[model samples]
Target: MKRPPYLKTSIGIGVLFIILMFLQSWLEKQPEALTASSEPETQTEATAVQPSERLVEDKRVYEGHNGTNLEHVYITIFDQSAVPENDITFYDLNESYKQYSNLDSGPKLDILFQTGTAKGPSDNGFISFGTDKPNATIELRGRSSRLEAQKSYKIRLQDNGGLWYGQSVINLNKHADDRTRVRNMLAFDYFRRIPDLISLRTNFVQLHVKDLTDPSSEGKFKSYGLYTHVEQLNEEALAARGLNPDGHLYKAENFEFYRYPDQLNHQNDPNYDKKKFEQVLKINGNENHDELLQMLDDINDLSKPFDEVFDTYFQEDNYLTWLAVNILFGNYDTMSTNYYLYSPLNSKKWYFIPWDFDKALGRDAERTDGLPQWQQGIQRYWGTVLHRRYLRDPENAAALTAKIEELSAIITEKTTKELIDSYYPVVKQLALQEPDLSYLGIEASEFDPAYRKLEQVTSRYKEQYMKSLEVPMPIFLHYERKNGRDVFTWEASHDLQNDKLSYEFQLSKTPGFESLIMQIKEQPDFTYNMAALPAGRYYWRVLVHDDKGHEQIPFDYYRDNAGIVYWGVQQIVVPGGSSS
Candidate 1:
């Protein structure tokens, strides 16, 4: 039978699944047999285990096979459920040990442990056993209505440190009805089904441990590694370059430099020579500065052709698709704090690379509040006010609006679903094969219900936003002649039935718009020309008023505010102009 394109792809995917299943069966069966056969001996010893004996038994030692000198000690979990005497299990470790769980109809199991240690080269010096390291501990918590229960689980080591650098998967537990068992089984199957798509990036492994000294502390007793985070240069990099602590051009050393706690102070007030650091940054590198500024200007220019590019490159519906995805995924830590920009030997252009993704996948607690304040205010503050005066004039707003609409279209349900479906097999394969990999968590299916809900809501908001953009007016011309005359023109239309369409124009040189050239009102299709203007870049826009004493609500205006409707602004260059 002839298969459709999508069907052919689906069938190919199914075949891959079969192969993975075969591989997983082979891999899991070996481990299952070993565990089952050893159960009797383990149970026999456990039966004879006394409180004092169990206390000693609770301490487990893990030694790296490689030359790496890493070691860890863990306290086993003590099952407290009211099960049969034979089914009961006990450990000397407290309940505060670490726990991990899977909530998507998969597995549930808690691993409790204490203390881990590592020495020699195997320790890699990159691993940390305390609470100071970020993501040192991984917790699996769930809110469930099926059993009317909300539970938090912890899994940790006896002693926190180990040096088996490279990738390793450790199965904490396997039981007939265990959620972790089920989840791992499914993940292994997925990986076996598509091995080619998976890759593992790290090898260090350590068990979670309870902070015996601080049991009640939040995020206490975690496992983590200490590795140098290679800084990335990207959009946030540009923001970093433009960041000024005092908001002044001088005093360049006032900027804060930080890596980890104890590396540097919150603000640099050291006795080091200010000129030395300034020379290192070379803030006066005019050519490099121009190139960086040009890149920013290009991004701004992209706003004008947004609709056309979105339609042709991203499909009309997918406008702002990438931006929306980033937001939905909780890439909210994009402010200047965690990212940096650098130039090697005065490069003409700067490039941006993503440095951190731990914040992605909506892992942070505060991320559930929906869109951030800064994003919501982009249109009002950036589009309406700042952009109007500095970035682009009102006439450019229409093009930008069209562009945003196109971007939104590109990220529509059909498109997003297609993207997810296409990547599902690959993501699942990676998750299964490299379950211990950091930064990249398991596939979409493993996410908590809250995470899924947040993603859906964010996507809907982006869609609605695209639909709400009003049509925009275009800036026609912005130029100043050598004669000290400044002229601004825009393509005008009088589609309204109201007569005597009055127009007004305003000019300002500064961003706050303190400097004014003139303010006048006339009919639609009006042009304003002024002479004796200073010779620097200027911003100007037009407004329309109805003669019938009725105010035309600024529907399409970049900033929806009363009074003076804005057309757009232009830069005027006068011959022999000087900054006043």
Candidate 2:
């Protein structure tokens, strides 16, 4: 029965009271209240716009805002050489910047210095925030996530000392508006707290670009809006993490080790066409990555014991940790891409590094049936193979499940809700004041209420996530197609929470399931006579649902690449000759 309104109100009050008390207790224990600091440790500020000045000017101080305290970073980039020449600049910064979206080779751009504030010396004024080096070279970055309006960037800090955060390369992420901006930040933050994993450091930076050629300009930089600053994983990053700096570092764009040089994934050559491989991975220090290829060879080798293959080639904890985190965050997009693989030069063990999490926290805006979309399918070949091995060994499955349970507390409703409650007011206040917010589909006028609603919508995900019942995958028994009747059976799924479960079998003409031809409900197996069905190809899968109305991705779906993008789902062709 539904609780009465007064009782529900009382329960809500009790929850809020507890949260407020907890936050108060937690804050009392901390040396400082949670706040945004522009600088980490390097503390390089090249300009006069001091941190104190920006905080004071931008209204980020806790002084006036409603319980909001912030110190947002600002970057002023000037085209020093583009000095106006007879109403024409030597280089058109604005136009040249636009061409990069379409051009294979973007124009070279140089930065004289990067200026930003520090949490420590806000009073010291804005200093040149960059590597010990003086300046930088900037270019476009990203693969499928790239957009013309919101562009990601790669900054090569001059080798001498131009690194930001004491590194040579930096990735500036322009998370599209459709993506919750905090998704990437939250993932990185969570990874950092986990032991043994190499987590990327992230911060927000406000960028401004100027066009010197336009005589209409009073010398002032135009706001480029907000961006998430991520340190590029390179040799320097490895060194920082106490690993071999010269170790082979590969940031996956579309990596599938099993398909090397086979047309899709990059070729397994140390000398794989630099330009071609550049499209997929940043092949750092290992132009001849024979070790990576060997690892893949070992992975695909059926003769090798499954336990030995993973234990010898991969630091399983790192893989397991990365896998566990992604699964909880609902980032299925990461299995094939949005990750980094690195190996020490002397040691053959490879580690998985987390990357690209803007799609996390929730699957997407729509919580249809309260299930996160990110939890749907693992569509990468490497992931599928690993999962297949996991199935072959129950020990690995138990261990993985254990890891998920252990980490689940971190993503629990109470914890995430607490974070959302505390962070929203501060970050929302800061993001709203950002200039050029229009490009991100954020308008200056809508800052107050827009961010408020975003926080509300974003945090609702935790409710569903916390209530979600973690169900073991269904097992595929056997399939037989006799007389054009396809019969598939699967072991029933059991809910860890003891929630009742029902099965739904689906067959679609397309992998996207845009149009469903058949649905079988409350059954563990399916029998569909397709002889009379169309002669084209079809995809099939079974979804197990709980009494709570949560559904689990089929076992075969996890063991193989499936979906509209991957065609990994079970399949049958009419007038059948073969099926997967």
The clash count for each model shown is: 59, 16
lDDT of 2 at 206: 55
CA lDDT, candidate 1, residue 272: 37
What lDDT score is found at residue 24 in candidate 1? Answer: 57
Q: Which candidate should be chosen as best, given lDDT against the real structure?
A: 2
Residue range 520-576, candidate 2, lDDT tens digits: 786644443444565667677777677766666553532224322322256656665
Model 1 per-residue lDDT tens digits across residues 13-88: 7787667667756856785432222222232322322211110111111122211122343422223341122122
In model 1, where do residues sit more than 4 Å from their true spots? 1-347, 350-374, 377-447, 471-580
Give model 1's TM-score versus the native structure. 0.28
